[model samples]
Target: MFEPGRLHLEHSPVQPPDVAYELIITYAPASSQDGPSMHFQVTGHIAGQPVDESFDLAADLAFNFASSIDHLARRHGLPATQVVPISLHRQYDEMFADIQHKLGRHCGDPVDARHLGKT
Candidate 1:
């Protein structure tokens, strides 16, 4: 399920029968000396393990969070091809636009090289 600033994913695998988990991601706009960015908090469990992590994404790159979600899912033992299952693309687009508006970011905006892990 997806809401403006949050997304929740749940999975129950049949192979392990006992395997089940949920992942929730919440994000908001933040600013540091480096500039504006998006702060994200991921909380939930994978199978029987608890998961709690946080990270920040440069505003210009925040829309790519789906890729990050895929990474997190894999790290938690989900299949490599598993990703956010958003049945409505329009909802994702709305969330993207909302984040962009909150961060005042637009296409072609300059991205900090440091945030890109270049330096």
Candidate 2:
């Protein structure tokens, strides 16, 4: 399920037998000190292991949050390719727009050069 500032994903692996997990992601604009960034929290469980982590990303890199979630899935023992599916592209677009609006970011705003190298 995808909401304006929240996304919830649940997955159960048939091949792996009893491994099932849920991932909930919430995001919001960061404080002024964070400088045009978004704050994110991922909380849930994977294969009976508790998962609670948070991170912040600059406006230009915020859209890649899904990839971050994929990394977390791998850390919890799920195969790289078998992570939760974010098939609703439309919902993602909505969430992206919402984040940009909250951050007062425009489509053509200049991106941080340092972040470009990281990508």
Candidate 3:
């Protein structure tokens, strides 16, 4: 569900299966001298245990999901709207790197898109 100015992805252990990596993303974008940055906090469960994490929310999502983003943004009447091109695939790659850096678990090779409910 998308609220006033936030986008949310909801899921439960029952939905994600065994490992139970369920996450909710709450983020806002910011324009800085360095570059654009997004602040996001994710709270959920990993293997049925609490997993709390945060990061500079880099824009990431499947191309097919753009309409979802637009829907939310329009619903909220967000201003200064602009379409910024970014590579979701690359962001996903970095996500694993960030996950490893923060979780102390190498999330490469072992994480299959098939297991993630993706083809």
Candidate 4:
């Protein structure tokens, strides 16, 4: 559930990926803070709700998104799944974690969520 900077890609030929998509590995420089925080955020339709997040550079935040989607797909019997690259808007580590907490779920492990292949 993310769309990269619409302006950033305006001049580029490739169109953005679809929702529940994954962008190729790309990085936006940290902001001008003393040491700007690095993060991963998701904003768009996901798992029956909108999702957004930010995380430290090393936290593999992207992986979490994919895992979460995977679980949801399995649970809901979606026909397909994909990973779209993400966009950044400066640093907001606390905000990202907050959103995750509000979701009250971690898209980790799927063995139990998928029963009889029907989530």
Candidate 5:
């Protein structure tokens, strides 16, 4: 799980000094067992202009953070790079499963039937 904190972006030659980006995440309970959805709020400055946006991801899709970031980067015309390294695919999968397990425990329910295929 990504800790809720300021994510220090890597220094890349393509990144402009005038642009600063930050991501804030929050979780909220939902009416369905497949919920307790996650919200990602991306805020930043681009060319001295403020930019902000939020995306709500259901629990089933919450593990696809890298893809979400790629889409966000594309929307902003920024470079889209793999957030998870290929070598870490196994670790990422384990971590995602752990998150699902913990969420189930905390929410007092099993994983949703619709998501059984995903696991």
Candidate 6:
């Protein structure tokens, strides 16, 4: 249940200065034992034209994000030397909290085994 946010572009010799990119993450409900999946979409404008690409991942969100950025950059013909490491800040704190709450409700939280050892 992630939402699309602002676009940011890193200035590099291989990448056009006028290009901008945005990454969007969305939740995908599945019956797999690994819990929910995530779909990462990278949309942007290159030379006044819109370019969009997406891929589904079942790994950790943070890892998926970085991989998605790299995938998009490569798909758009951007050179590896021009690729920049994207840093996702804590701006989605509230959104993440909400997602946690929802996931907790949908999928029961992990039991604290340490509590079973107590009297």
Runs off by more than 4 Å, candidate 3: 4-17, 31-33, 57-119
What TM-score would every model get versus the actual structure?
0.76, 0.79, 0.36, 0.25, 0.48, 0.45
- lDDT per residue as tens, model 6, 1-119: 23433334434244354344443434432333444544445666433446576655442342234545666666666555544345444434533444444334333444334333221
Give the CA lDDT, 0 to 100, for residue 75 in model 2.
Answer: 84
User: What's the lDDT for all of these models?
Assistant: 0.73, 0.76, 0.37, 0.31, 0.46, 0.45
User: What's the true lDDT of residue 90 in model 2?
Assistant: 48
After superposing candidate 5, which stretches have Cα over 4 Å from the reference?
Answer: 14-34, 45-50, 80-102, 105-119
Best by lDDT: 2
Clashing pairs in 5: none
The runs of at least 3 residues in candidate 1 whose Cα sits more than 4 Å from the true structure, single-residue gaps closed, are 14-19, 86-90
Q: How many steric overlaps are in each model, in order?
A: 0, 0, 1, 9, 0, 0
Model 2 stretches astray by more than 4 angstroms = 32-34, 87-90, 117-119
Off by over 4 Å in 4: 1-28, 31-37, 58-81, 85-119
Q: Write the per-residue lDDT of candidate 3 for residues 26-64, one digit (tens) a residue.
A: 555544343444455555543455645444522222222
lDDT of residue 56 for candidate 1:
81
For candidate 3, what is the TM-score? 0.36
TM-score of 5: 0.48
Candidate 6 Cα errors over 4 Å, as ranges: 1-35, 46-49, 59-62, 88-119
For candidate 1, the 10 contiguous residues with the lowest summed lDDT are: 80-89
Write the residue-wise lDDT of candidate 4 on 1-119 in tens digits: 22231111111124343233222222232332323323433333433443333333322232233344344434433234332211242222333444344333245623233222221
